[model samples]
Target: MTDFDQFEDEDDTPKSKTQIKREMEALQEIGKKLLQLSKSQQKKVPMSDTLRDALNEADRIKQHEATRRHLQYIGKVMRSEDHQAIEQRLALFDTTSAAYNKLFHQLELKRDALIGENSKEELANYLDEHPEVEDIQTLRNLIRQSQKEVSQQGKTTNRKKLFRFLRETEEKRLGLAE
Candidate 1:
């Protein structure tokens, strides 16, 4: 049997002092290494485009790995009959939805900052030229009303397809497939 199996089968037998000490030392070493890595990463700011690109690639790889693992877990859940699998899938869906929401919020913040920094005429002209910017209804309405007051607009705004796949995926996850 595995070590975990043996441990689970046993009664309230406390771990041996030596085992406890060894585990504690191992954890301490892990903690030390984590601290050292954090310190080094903090100190090593990228000074060149190459280093920045390398860091971006590393981050992309890490995110891809995480997404792969999450997909594997979902696939495993799909194959299993356990109720826990349903719960796990729901939890994963919630996490994915929250992440997307956070991303959209950050994008909205950036868009707002850009609009705020520009002059009224400049912002209206930009909105007229980039009609897709109005696809975000709330932002679009705000810009539309503001444009009316300024009257130095250029052209009409139009909606563009955005987050359509994400919406469909979310719908499927919630069992509201259409």
Candidate 2:
């Protein structure tokens, strides 16, 4: 009916106080999860130096009230960070995450190929593709062991070792290894 009323009607609605509080709580929960991660795991997640320092401090705080306050500070710091990127990296550490499962399956397939009937050619191709493979001899040895076990229908101890080696190689390639 008046100029003020018209301006209010045209303005976009701001977030309600309750909405803001809920969002803050969600970020705090994320901070709590980050704190739960080991030091090595924390390094994998991309974060600003300030946030990293805050997390480190949070780790040292043992008193109940001080720890609680520091967690809130962490939540504040996390507000300025890329939540999605942090979550994606964190999900890599979770075995149930789709990304983790996909990587695991791919490694399994590669390991199987390396120990399969066509392993000689597959190993050659794999080495060519991943020239960064540090210990070619060890990889070949493991593959050979796994192949022998498969042919004899024996327990797959070497196959497991081969899979583990492949996983370690992948982690190093991805810069997730120490």
Candidate lDDT values, in order = 0.39, 0.85
Top candidate, metric lDDT: 2
TM value for model 2: 0.80
Q: Estimate each model's TM-score.
A: 0.21, 0.80
Q: After superposition, how far is residue 65 of candidate 2 from its true place, in Å?
A: 3.7
lDDT of the structure predicted as candidate 1: 0.39
* Candidate 1 error regions (>4 Å): 1-96, 118-178
Q: By summed lDDT, which 10 consecutive residues of candidate 1 come out lowest?
A: 157-166
Model 1 TM-score relative to the real fold: 0.21
For residues 1-178, could you state the per-residue lDDT of candidate 2 as single tens digits?
Answer: 5312322323666556666667667778888888889999999888999999998888788899998888788877777799888887777788889999999999999999988889889999898888889899999899999989999998989999999999988888777787
Error of 1 at 16 (Å): 18
